[model samples]
Target chain A: MTTSDSSPTVRTPLYNLHVELGAKMVPFAGYDMPVSYPLGVLGEHNHTREKAGLFDVSHMGQAYLTGPDHDTCAAALEALVPGAVLTLGKGRIRYTQLLNSDGGIIDDLMVTRLVDDEDDGRLFLVVNAGCKHGDYAHIAAHLPAGIHLEPIEDRALVALQGPGAAEMFATICPEASEMGFMTAIRTDINGVDCWISRCGYTGEDGYEISVPEPQAEEFARLLLAHEAVEAIGLGARDSLRLESGLCLYGHDIDTTTSPVEADLMFSIAKRRREEGGFPGYGRVRSEIENGPKRIRVGIVPQTRAPAREGTEIQSNGETVGVITSGGFGPTYGGPIAMGYVSPEFSSPGCEVDLIVRGKTMPAKIAAMPFVEQRYYRKPKV
Target chain B: MSNIKYTEDHEYIRVDGDIATVGITDFAQSQLGDVVFVELPEVGASFEQGEDAAVVESVKAASEIYAPVSGEIVEVNTALEDEPTGVNSDPMGNGWFMKIKLSKASELDELMDEDAYKALVASQS
Candidate 1:
């Protein structure tokens, strides 16, 4: 929403294209972004599931960390996040959280080591748009001499997600379809160099391509020309990630929630959990050993109404927790949600109530994802 | 249809004697995008003007639909339960939410007439 006197929002490279496509633009994370297009949220959600959906994620923060060697760069990153970056192979991606001293998450991010023989000293990073500036500052301040954090200001990121993504991407970059999940490669489409990763937040097989800002519009138009691809917006993006039970930075996890409580204990490497050197490692280690008081669990409201973010969650007439994300699951055909509840009520099928508009609606703790994830992984011999 | 009036909140009231048909205006439905579900008041329930009476859920969020006038619910639409998209398809016709038997017919006078409602919507966009 915008007001006449409100501060003007910055536009991404795809702004004009979004307007031409009839996108309903809204203010998000200090940027004027599309919330939905002519296809609508429901159609966009279903289309992404059945076919391919292209998203403008250019607002995300992209940067590089470089050092004298891979070890030097990895060591500097290890000091900040809970992930074991020291062992990360070139071109391999690791999902981890940058933490505060108490093991509280500063931001969740993707870290990818550059694969080329000469580029071993560099690592590619993608962080949340809202937390990018603080993340860069945090990483830079913690880095020692010979290691540097350089934010990429001239790039646009896009995500091509769904079952049909493979074929559409094959038309441009065939090697992208061959790559396994969580791997990155520097490639070109129609001669435009791109940094592509075979991963996405939609819980589907997809690619996130980082393109030079100058060619972002051209790159987007090329991808949109594919028959299987449609322009999806932020509205569907939230719902898709919610259905997959993925955490949205400020909503599901923040300075208050630790990885263990958010059911993201997998993000912390085993060695890191044992050695404990990162910021907030003490809290994360303690929580992992002695469990978090409340844990994140998926909630399925038995009724048609949804209990959105901040809706009170109750168990046995007493307030237990609150909903972090909830909405009508277009694919699931009913309302689905995720929230933190008492450890006792975190098990699947545990009945609870969601307070919506003063009414305590019946809901039950269900195991995520609301739908099965279809990430493409090669069959190992 | 001659007595059809609208509330600033986008509820439309078509007066047929003392029984008034109520539903969200087309403009409201268009703004809400896809209609996924609806929660309507039970028959005989009474509401003061501007009171929360129903809920219309779209894929993105659930929005509360307010009552346009003080009245008692006479009939509730059951068709919406099976076909919620009627709200997006025919919000004024088959998508009618409820019928209210006016408790005080004078409340209708306070509602916006067609031209006034159109002007209000114009100012908003």
Candidate 2:
């Protein structure tokens, strides 16, 4: 859909900070966001790898879903997403996608069973910035009478991600030092009550802190005060997520693409696969048994030249697919990308060619997480 | 350090009779953000006025550099292969993209002066 001029585009609480930092701002997901800072996309990509990077993810949707009891709410959520919500222990989080009736991804989101303050049975949810409004509307419409979807529009999200992220957060929020990856807690940080999730999109050990909008600027400042945290923008965010094999909505996956076709079958639990009640269950089930015609795979360009979005993917001198995302991967030390390719050529180690500026450059289909994902997991007690 | 003439597309040309040293304007580099790679034309390659002569790629986008006037490429900045950032760091000096032997001497008259170029930038901004 075209981004309408009249559509209400919300700005993150840290919008001013981006302008102050001389960030090159552009419209993304209905928000004016900084694509990069003076360090530029390349330097910013490298900075996030070598040190901690502070990203203003405030534009991401933060919401809460509550039902009469934990069991009911968990089952209600599972009906919409593919995750086994009830099986999740308290303080644990799962990455799942909100799907349309056709079983196509509406948006990728995180859901955590929060420690109910009043025993009200609440589930903390975070969704993509671009799809937040539609996600909320879709969930609200599908939810039962007792189930309620509350949009926390006034909250701001910040992702402090990288190798140095854990240590940096530990200095400010000591309680979080013990938290493991995909685990979350409603904790106080420097006197501000916030929800801290030990998760990030950067393929690094990091935390996504959800703070009240009013306190966001100060919290960002506090994080930046640490030596390791450099301000990162959308440019690095895209590159980091791409390197991690995560899909970006509108570019990689959309309402037209199914989870199975997108190579996101890992997200669908076995129970859900068999029960087959979700929208487009038959289509998704068939694709699961019979592989999709084209699958998303990682492409590592043999040369330094980047094969950007829309560049054709060719095999045996014939166009098979197109690149959806690509750039210089600082961690990989060369150009890396993700694109759709015919199933016959989708296997890892498959050779392909990317038609970059009319020149066919040799590339290989590599297994994703081109770099190792460094999620922080607690040691076995 | 010579008097530079500017083109509407933001290229800058410094001419001394039949030879012209060419590079993108400071405005162009700033607009492109960070230069990462440059595809320079072969030294002996001949091009007509407004023909695609080179390519400059930044972190996010790429643009073609069109020759302001028909000319024969004499030299290209090989330094850009290793140090494309030089264009953002020093657009007019060591970052000079290429030098060309002008096929038409009076074509320089069609370019703009610094004042006119600055006015164009101001109006656009």
Candidate 3:
């Protein structure tokens, strides 16, 4: 594995805390992040699925787009991404992709519209750590002069995820339990100001708390003090997101992969699709109507051998696709993977071979989310 | 007790006459973190020293186990097929990966004793 020895690595606010907790540090996205703790990857993964896990996701990029009004700010952002940002409800969040001129994804991100009585337009955005600099530069270059893209460098993000997350957060801040999925609220947790969003990458009902840098460690410690919570590392974070079938920015959905081919068509709102004004509207619209040539799909090895990234996928001796994100799923008790394949071989149950270390391992195309998602959506009244 | 020797790659060999028991050390298992699968060479297969003789996979990645000395595989660890975590729990005992019939007993002279191997591990760390 690659070590953080080549360049000076950046540390998050919880760097000392991770070391005190016995985290094995590794280089990830230009940061010295913890890969796993003393519990090991398997134990940490299982614990997150069964209970609550606190993740220090401070390496992610956080920023805000501000303007005179919501329409101005939303329209400025809509020019870059294909999502219907103009109509995004107040206090609501939307998953979107920043696309290149050719309809290829630059980065996938989360955009949340905050509720403000003054109507001073502001939208919060969270981008991948590796692509943050590029994403910020792209936004600044394309947005109108009146609109400003402000990077929130003084804040840290932490995610409390898994089955018991809602209950644990409710104890500290009761209002958190009332927020529906894909919604955000500015709340105070034990007097620490935070922006808590009711969403996560783990396909579980959870909250992502954006807190000030100075109070980040203290806030994390408070939540970790709960009986159901354990401090998770990047190793388990990867497996949890894989089991949820969520794409990692650079790995699964990169500049070479279009949003449609990446199976993120739902992120394109109806109005945006009909209007077609986004950067890659021409290619994205065509792909939406005619379907993409290649699509992302889930793959499960028929054997115990795990097919890792860069492993070639084949069908009857012909190389068809390649594994992008793969590993052993602790919950599934087997090797699970996601990759891009030709449309002909993308259906669930289609058999293929994963070339691992010059050996062909049997695998089959399966419907994504090898694990069932349990996002909490408030029942309609 | 049988005479024990070590390889730089973190494998250990316990010799009793011409027969030898081979397995990875505790340090190797700890670095691997939770062994999930092990692929052993078939009995009767022969390999030269430093040749890839087996494969061990942890949750994170896979690694090849090299032969410490020229030998013919005599017995393979079948229990690892179902319980690979034994390699982590009892790396030197029940986790013994295989047994081999040494082609040349004199090969042990080139291997490290416990003291030298410990020094090497310390230096690497």
Candidate 4:
């Protein structure tokens, strides 16, 4: 967790804002990102569960894919991912992953089907910051004629997430209150054109606003001025997502990890699962039918000591798995982790030992989202 | 406080005759941020100067507390095992890690005094 200093890193639009709020800035994914603020990581984590915490996620890549119509555009994207991009409804967002030919995840992203008829063929994508350039190039290279993938470079992405987020949004963006989970809208905020999504990495009911670069700081300040919102940094962001059982791109899911093995089969559309047109369809289909050899699962250490990343997991004294992301869960009440283990040991209550500093600590395979997910979903009648 | 000596690693040693109370400095606790857990050495354990004696875990990382001088652990702070926030709240007082019976009282001469430690901390920022 040392700050990178050898090479210069770029800064986000909120760099000055973070500094103004006394943040501990560290180089992350080629950007000078804020890791924590004066509120502290633990305080920020708890705050987001009780109140809205604003996070600057501008480093993520935002792009637009355009074609003759939804059919042509979906076909191009479907070739790379297993998600049902073709069936996505207007204004609805679908979470998917970019796959290599080997059934490995290149990156996980959010794809939104635009609402306006003029933007009929357009699909908006938000990808991981570190893999954005590669993802864009890969998508562009694979696109058929008449389709275009344009990277939106001048935008700052921010999230306001928590239990109180909806109440806060109801006062400002009244339309947001009626939004279902994973829905988005393009609207003007104080005359500033923005894209708002009723989705966030933290499992709480919240929204992500994409503000243009010039007005980003002003927009961020506007939210910070609200009593319900407090500025959060990357430290809490990691813990929040970890507690939510969500995957972090490089840490939890990498190019070598497939969706099935990563326990992200939900993202694979049922139609795609049956039709199988994606790049790694063969392996994905086989894994779906036969089950993956290793399965990702949640880990809860029995002791106060956390089993951090790279901690070896042993069952009956034989090594069975390794932790990918582990830390103190401020909201979950104790140490929580997620990692891959042999199939037989992947069930909840399956006992395991975490070897930390040569000492074996007892743990169990617990169910994910250590804290139950609180996403706001519209009632189905 | 006048009898206290400091280490470059941000440990404080308060000497009373041949016995000393050892804990992380307030500066170190602040730098480490939130403290989640603390692993203390057993009372009978013996350690050499610079050897790992205890472990402290923050939310993001695990750090070792080295033995500031060659000594035998006389007492361990067991309260921290159940409530580690003491490391952040009163790190210099109730958050003390251990009490050691020095094998060689002369080893204290090698540690930084109050003025020198303050200067070292000042230089860092």
Off-target runs (Cα >4 Å) in candidate 1 are A1-5
RMSD of each: 1.7, 2.4, 1.7, 1.4
Order of the predicted models by lDDT, top scorer first: 4, 3, 1, 2
Give the least accurate 10-residue stretch of model 4 chain A, judged by summed lDDT.
Answer: A1-10
lDDT of 3 by residue, A121-196 (tens): 9999999998999999999999997999999999999999999999998999999899999999997777899999
Candidate 2 docking: what grade? medium
Give the TM-score comparing model 1 with the true structure, all chains together: 0.97
TM-score of each: 0.97, 0.93, 0.96, 0.98
TM-score of chain B of each: 0.96, 0.95, 0.97, 0.97
Better of 1 and 3 by DockQ: 1
Pull out the clashing pairs in model 4: none
How far residue B51's Cα lies from its native spot in candidate 2, in Å, is 3.4
Name the candidate, 2 or 4, with the larger lDDT value: 4
* C-alpha DockQ of every model: 0.83, 0.50, 0.72, 0.80
Residue range A1-381, candidate 2, lDDT tens digits: 113265666678999988898898877778888888988777888888888999998988889898988889888888888777878888888988888888788999999988655644789999988888899999999998899999998889999999899888888888888998899888887777789999999898899999988999999999988988889988788878888888888888888888888888887889888986677788888888987877888999887677888899998899988898887676786678898998988888988899988889999999998888888889998
| TM-score-best of 2 and 4 | 4
Q: Which stretches of candidate 3 lie over 4 Å from their true place?
A: A1-5
**How would you class the docking of model 4?**
high
Pairs of residues at least 3 apart in sequence or in different chains that clash in candidate 3 = none
Lowest lDDT sum, 10 consecutive residues, model 1 chain A, at A1-10
